[model samples]
Target: MLMVMDEPKPNHWVFFSVAQNSPDFTLTIVFFILPHSEVKMGLKQTIKSLDAFPRAEEHLLQKTQTGALVSVIGLVIMATLFFHELRYYLATYTVHQMSVDLKRGETLPIHINMTFPSLPCDVLSVDAIDMSGKHEVDLDTNIWKLRLNSNGHIIGTEYLSDLVEKEHADHKHDHDKEKDHPHIHGFDQAAEALVKKVKQAIAEGEGCRVYGVLDVQRVAGNFHISVHGLNIFVAQLIFDGSKHVNVSHMIHDLSFGPKYPGIHNPLDGTVRILHDTSGTFKYYIKIVPTEYRYISKDVLPTNQFSVTEYFSPMTNSERAWPAVYFLYDLSPITVTIKEERRSFLHFITRLCAVLGGTFAVTGMLDRWMFRFLEALTKPKRRKETECGSLSGDGCCFGGN
Candidate 1:
C-alpha cells in the first residue's frame, strides 16, 4: 500500500491511501484533528482586563493645561527623590554593635616608646606586675635603649643582652652567682660598674629612650619604668639622693594591639615634666577590644582605650621610687564595626514608592482644581442663557 499525507493545518491532518496490489482498486481517506482549542483559548485568556496598572487609549485621553502642569511638577519631585536615594545607596556606612567579650587565654601585645630626659639608661628599668601575681621583672629581651645627649640627639644604641654581657666580661672574677643574683634586685661588683658608668653619663648630661613590644597575659596589670629593680645601695649611689631622681618622660606611642585604620591611641605624643621634686606618674587605662569588618569580608582585630592620669609626690622614704607607670584593665565588652551598603532591592522598592505616590497625589489635585473651576463657571453660563431667551442680544442684565 502507498500512503500519502497532505500538508498539515492548524488542529487537523488529512491522509489518503491506495491499494498497490490491485492497481488502485480502493482509495481511502482519513482525517485527524488535534485537541489544541483549549490550550489556545487558555493562553489568550491569560491576558485579562483585571490589571493592577491600567492605561487609557490615546484617543480617550484628554490633556488639560492644569494636568500638564501637575505632571511636570510631579516629574521634578520624583527626580529629586531619585537622586537622593541614589546617593544614599552608593555611599558606604559603618554599623557599630556591642557584645559581651568571650575571648579566653589570650595574650595582649603592647607597644611602648618612651623617652626620659633626666634619667640615665643604667638607672631606668622596665617591670610589670599583674593582679594574677604574675611578675615580669626587668623586661629587657625585646627592649632597646637609645642614649641621647643634652640636645636630644641619639648618641648610641644598646641592646639589653649586649650591655649585660659587656658588664659581666669586665668584672668576671668578682661575680658571685648565689648572693649577687638574688631575685635580679641584688647588684654585685658588675652592678657597681654600671653605677659608675651612669654617674659619668650624668656628668655629661645624658638621656635615654626606651622602645619595644611587651606581650603579657590578658588581665589587669601595671607596667612601669623606675629604679625599683636595682639594689638599694646601687640606686642610692647612682644619684646624690633618691629625691633628686627626676622621672620626667615623653611617650611617643603606646597601644594595646595591632594598629588599624581609624584607631586612635590617646597616649601618643604625651609629655610629662617634673620640677625640682621627684614624683610618680600613673596612667589608669580601660581597654576595650574591637573588631573591624571590611566590606570585602576581611576582619581586623585591635583595641581602643581611655585613660585617666594621676601624679603623687615622692617623700624622703628610702622605699619610695620615682617612675612612670601605666596601669590597665580590660573591659568585659567588645565592639564590632562593620562596613555595609544598601541592598539593590531596597533601593528599587523605595524608588517605586516615591514615583507612584507623587503621581497619584498630583492626579488627585488636578481633578479637584478642574472641578472647582467648572463649578464657578456653571452659574454664569446658566444666567447668560436665561437672559438671551427672555430678551434678545440688546438686553442688559447688569450695568454693563
Candidate 2:
C-alpha cells in the first residue's frame, strides 16, 4: 500500500471530469510537478473523488516507509524493559556503614569491701547474696532469688542481711529486699564488723578491692573502668626504689570500656586493652554484680583475653553490636528495604517497553492500512486532460 504526492505535470489534466472546476471545493494540497513558467490558465485547484481521477502506480511507495519507522521505536522501548529486569536480579544489596556513637559506660553504684575469715585476716573478702524471689510458678513475674553458696566456704545468706543495713545507713534506709529474712539481727553491727575488718586490713598493709569481678566476667567481657573517686583510689604503687611511689601515673595508663557490661559469654568473659598505654604494666580488674547470673570461676584473673577498651560509644557492651551489623543486611526484611530502592525503577522500564513496543506495532499496522485504504478510496491525478487547468490534480488529495 502507498500514499503519494506529485508535482502537477503542466498541460496535462485529463480534464474530462466535471469534478475539476474553476471555483468552490478547495482541496487540502496542490501539486505542480511541471514547469510553472508554461503560463498556464489557473492550474489545479478543487478536490473530487478518484472516480474522477487516476494516477501512475509509482507514487504509492512513500506511505509504507512511514509505518516502518514507527514500528522500530516501539520495539526499542519494549526491549529496554527486558534488559532492565535482568540487571535488577543481579543487583546486590549494599550496606553503608559509619562509626556510630553508642551510649555505654554506666557506673554501677554498688561496691564491696573484701574480707577473709581465716588467712592472716589480711585478705578481707566480702560477699553478699539476695535471692528470696525465685522458685515461684511464674518465672517472668517471679524475682530470681539470690542465694548463698551453702555448698562451699562462702556463706551468702548471712552476708546479704548484714551488708545491706550498714551500707544504706548513710541514707537511713533498710534492706527491703530482705523482708523475708526478718530473723537476721543487728544488720548495722554486721556491716560495721565487715567495714572495721576492711579498715584494719588496709592499715596493716593489705589488698582492698571491689569484690565479685568474677561474676561480671562470667556475663560481660572485661571492659574499661572509670574510678569516680580517683583521689581516694587504692591502686598498686610501683616502687622506683625512691621515697614515693606515684600510683597516679599507673592509673593514667588504664582505660575503661563501655558501660553496659557486655553480654553473657561463659567462655567470652574477660577483659583486655585496645589501646597503647604509657605504663609497662596495667592493673586490670573486673567488678562483679551483687547477684550472680550463674556460677563463675572462683577468682578472676588480672589478664585473660585480648580486650579493646575505648572511651567512645562502642563499649565493652554485653555483646558488641557493631560486629553483627551485617546481619541486618542479608535478613529477609532487608529484601523490602532493597526493593524500596530497586523495584520501582524496574517496573517503569518494563512498562515503558511494553507501551513502546505496542505503540510501534500499532504504528506499523496503522500506517500500512492507512496507505492501503488511501489508495483504494482517495482520488488520483489524471494523466490526460485539458493540459492546463486549475482542477485536475487528483482532486488535490489532502496531504498525500
Candidate 3:
C-alpha cells in the first residue's frame, strides 16, 4: 500500500546475490589450487621413485663366481670409459666469443732483442714507419745498443738515446762557443769530445746487439735496424771500405707485450741475412688478437701473428740500404678461449646412465653365454649315458 512494504532494499538484494554465489566461488578456488598441489605431490613422488633402489627376487640377485668376475670386469671397463668420456667432454667444452675494439690510434709496444754479428754498434740505426705516414728515425728512446766482439760476446752497453743526447749537447756547445767567441777559454773542448767519441767507436768491435721496446700505432707498421754509417765520415774512415758488414742476426725475444712462459714467437730466435750484399728483408705479418680465460678466472689478452718473408738483393743500379722490415696488420675479429667444467648434475646423470646400461647389457650377455654352454654339454652327456646303457652296464646319469 502506501508503505510499499519498505521496498526490498538495495543492500538486501546485494547480500542475497553474494550468498547465492558463495558456494560457486569456493569450488572455483579449490579447483584452481587443488591441481597445483596434486602436481607438486606427483613430482615429489617421481623424484623419490627415481632415487629408490630396485627390488628383485633373491635368486635373481645372487651372483656366481663367473658372474661376479664378469661384473667386476664390466665395472672396471665402464669406469674407464666414463673417465675417458668425461675427459673428452671437458676438453671440448670451449666457449668462443667476439667483441669490438673501438679504441683507435692506440699504441702497441713491440719488445725486441736482436743481435747482428757483423754490424758495428756505432753504424746501426733504428727506423720505424706506419701506413699513416708517421715516421720515426734513429729511435733511441727506450733502446739499448750493446757493443759485442767478433766472438758474439757483449763488451759494453749504453742507452741509445743517452748517446745521441750527449752528441747533440756537444754540438750545441760548439755552436754556443762560436756565438760567444770572447768567452772561449779552452782549446775547443766540444771538438775534442767529438774526436774522442769517434776514436772510441772505431776501436770498438764489429758485432752489435739491440734490445728495446718500440711503441707504434695499432695499425700496420714496421721497425728496422740498418747499417747506414757508411755516410758518416768517422765510420767511413774507420772501416775504409775494407770489410763487408755481415747482417746475420739472431732474434732473442720478439713479442707484442711482456714475456710469458711457454709463449712462442715465430720470429724469435730467427737468424737471417747470410749474405753481405746490400738488400732488404721484409716480413709481412698478420696479427690476431686473442683473449684466454682459464678455469681459475684468469684472463689474458695476447696476440698471435703469422709472418711471410721476402728478400730483395741490392743491384748496382739500385744499391738500397740493407734493412729488416716488419709489416704488420691487425685483424678485426677477436678470438676468445674459455675453460669450463661439467655441471655436477650432468655428471651424475651420465654416471647413472653408464652404470645402468652396462649392468643390463652385461647381465644379458652372461645369461646367454651360460645357456649356450649348458646346451652344448647336455647333448654330450646324453650320448655318454646312452653308450653306457648299450654296453649293458648299470648306467648312472650323475644321480639323475
Candidate 4:
C-alpha cells in the first residue's frame, strides 16, 4: 500500500509512506512552520505561564481607600526594614576567641615615653632585669633623652654616646685651660668648681624626657630608671642625699607590642608625683597576647595588659635608690580577634522575611478594615405590613 500527500506550500512540509507487505498500511505526516515573530511570542507565553504571581486587568480590579493607606504604610515599613538590613549587611563585626599561647622564643617589644620633671638627663639611666637573671645596664640602643627646662620645653636631645663624648670634651677643655693658666686653679680646685657648676645648673630646673622602644624576652621582667650608672658616693654628692631625690615622673605612653584596633594600654598618660620624699614607684602589669585577623586575612600580633601600682618610700636606715620600676609578666592565654561581615544569603533571608511578613500583615489589616466599612455603609432592610380583611388570602405588602 502507498499513500501520497499534496505538494508542500511555503514554510510547510508533507510526507508519504508505504508498507511493502500489507496493502492497507499507509502513513502520512505534515508540519506547518510558524514565522520567527510567532515563535518568539509562543516561547514568551510559555515562560509567562510559569509565573506564580498573576496580574488582574486594571479595568477589572477595584481599589479601596483602606487598601491604599495600608499600601503606603507597608511601603514605609518595608523601606525602613530594608535600610536596617542594609546597615547590618554592610557592617563588620569582631569575634573574640581564646586559646593557649604556644609560641616559643619570641621577643616582646616595649614602647615607653616618660617625662621626669624632677630628674635631670645627666644622672638618669634605664636598666632592665629579667627573671632569668639577664640584666641590661644603661640601655643605650634605640633610646633617646630630651633635656627639658622648667617651662617643660625641649632644650636639647642626645643619646648616651653623645652625652659621654660631650662630657669628655668638657674635661679636655678644662685640662687645656689649666695648662694655659698654671697658677689660676689646680686640677682639684677645677674638679670642685665643675661639681659646683653642675649643682647650680640642676637647681636652675632642667628636666629629662625619655622615649623609645625596648625588646626583651617573652617572660617576667622588671625595668627601672634610676642613678644605677653612677657610683653611690657621686650620686649622694650630687643630690645631697638619696632621700632628696625626687622620682616624680609622668608616663606618656607604655605598650608591650605594636598596637592594633581596639588595643588599650592601661598606663598611658599616667602621672606620679612624689613630694618632699624619695620613693620607688612600681607598676605591676600582666600582659595578654593578642592576634588581630583582618577580613583580608592579614594577621597582626599584639598585646594588651592591666596594671597595679605600689609606692615604697625610702627609710633612713635602708640603703637603696629611688626609681620608677615597671614589673611585667605574661599570661598563657592568647586572644584572637577577627573582623567579619554578614553573608549574602543571610541578607537575602532577612529581606524575604521582611517583605513577606509586612505584606501578609498589611493585607489582613486592609481586608478587615474594608469589611468593617462595608458593613457600616450597607442599608438595613425593614419589614412592614398593611392588613385588611378582603378575601380568603391575606393582603401584605413590604418594601425596603
Q: Give all candidates' CA lDDT scores.
A: 0.78, 0.30, 0.65, 0.77
Instruction: Specify the poorest-scoring 10-residue window by lDDT in model 4.
Output: 164-173
Model 2 gets an lDDT of 0.30
Model 1, runs deviating above 4 Å: 1-91, 135-141, 161-189, 342-400
TM-score of 2: 0.19
Ranking by TM-score: 4, 3, 1, 2
Worst 10-residue stretch by lDDT in candidate 3? 165-174
Leading candidate by TM-score = 4
Determine the backbone clash count of candidate 2: 44
Worst 10 residues of 1 by lDDT: 165-174
* Model 1 Cα shift for residue 36 (angstroms): 29
Expressed as tens digits, the lDDT of each residue in 6-72 for candidate 1 is: 5677774333343434575555545554547765675667765456677889999888888888889
**Model 1 — TM-score against the truth?**
0.58
lDDT of 4 by residue, 361-384 (tens): 998999999988878765332222
The list of candidate 4 runs beyond 4 A from truth reads 1-84, 135-140, 161-202, 353-400
lDDT of 2 by residue, 280-324 (tens): 112223422221111222321111122222222232221111110
